[model samples]
Target: AKTSGGFAPFSHTVTSVTHHKGSSTVRALSMISSQSTSAEISWGIPTGSEGRKLRYIISYKCVNQLACSPGCQDAVEGRLTQENTRMTLSPLLPFTQYLVTVTPEDGLPSEIYVGTSEAVPTEIPSLSFRSPDRTNTSLTVYWEPTIVCSS
Candidate 1:
């Protein structure tokens, strides 16, 4: 029998239903360019996920963790919400390797390895003059290497 509201009896009708959404994931990550202290990257989202603002959880860590001071080597993370595929990470150490991961909301994360370029030397060189070899017209001088010797 139908009730006044045209509904079945409470005991005979469905009370509630839960619908599960499909799972999507970040598909790809690529490096666009790099500088001495920054990196620009791009990523791909799952098909059919375009045009909608998506929140990305971005995290990065230096591959050479030993280079940083203790308690300062933790991974850096940030959140961004946009429909575009490009973003920039800055204030990174020069000539270092980093592992970057981007996880879109409700999706699996994509990871990539990136490297920053070497920066110009910032240390001042130490110069010493040899008095024994110095003359009015000629002089001998020695200078200590300023930048770290990578060779």
Candidate 2:
């Protein structure tokens, strides 16, 4: 049916419809250890998935059931644009074992990386020093928060 600024009616029968969206084959996985209660993860874009729009889904949980107590289910899930392949999960239980997985939109279920969060002090302690040991001391330190941080 065709319409030219007027009402038109059309009807048809369909057998089936299929979409052939491809999947990303993860080439590599890199993880940044969690300092206190988080971890950073990034992976190489799949060779075939490049230049194509996609989405990323990350699922994680505490590996040891005992750590989670009665439920032992500390699962966490998130979704992000394909461009934002890397992400950080924070506020996780400190000193806990976890299993993490990254899957593309419609990708298969799989677990590729496993890591533990760093142990943290009950409180953020201030940097303290005592009596410079009666000797002159000097130190230079550099701190970078994330990959996107400038300077």
Candidate 3:
């Protein structure tokens, strides 16, 4: 139907719709270890929008069943830029599983994207000492691998 202003009226009927909207993608993710403190995470920014605003949110938890949560603990928002898209999460427990998300301000749906990193093991590798003889010396070491899963 045509409107009084000579424009086609908006309709809910089934019709062919073509949209040329752009999307955002995560480029890189990494975690930095600190001394007796929380680990730091640095996330790469998504590229596509020329000058649109962007917001970021991060969530994390321990690997233990009692400590891990379904949703994120902290929510952070900020404007999108070419240089400042990366952020750091601090004060987090050592050796814990963390889930990070990045959302951008675009007209397209599914703004939130999530990524996860395995928890760093808190315990150090066990080692044993052995001596062959008084004149000859020998050493032995043992270690374990960190376990991580992807969904």
Show where candidate 1 strays beyond 4 Å.
1-23, 65-83, 126-138, 143-151
Pairs with backbone N, CA or C atoms under 3 Å apart (clashes), candidate 1: none
Please name the candidate that would achieve the greatest TM-score relative to the true structure.
Answer: 1
Candidate 1 Cα lDDT to native: 0.70
Residue pairs with clashing backbones, model 2 = none
TM-scores of the candidates are 0.65, 0.55, 0.37
lDDT for residue 94 in candidate 2, whole number 0-100: 57
| Among all candidates shown, the one with the greatest lDDT | 1
How many clashing residue pairs are found in candidate 1?
0
- Please give, for residues 64-150, the per-residue lDDT of candidate 2 as tens digits: 532335423544444444457777876566555567777777665345544544452444334444333333576544343322101
Model 2 residue 110 lDDT score? 42
Model 2 spans with C-alpha error above 4 angstroms: 1-17, 65-83, 120-151
What RMSD, rounded to one decimal, does every model reach? 5.5, 12.0, 12.1
* TM-score of model 2 (CA atoms): 0.55
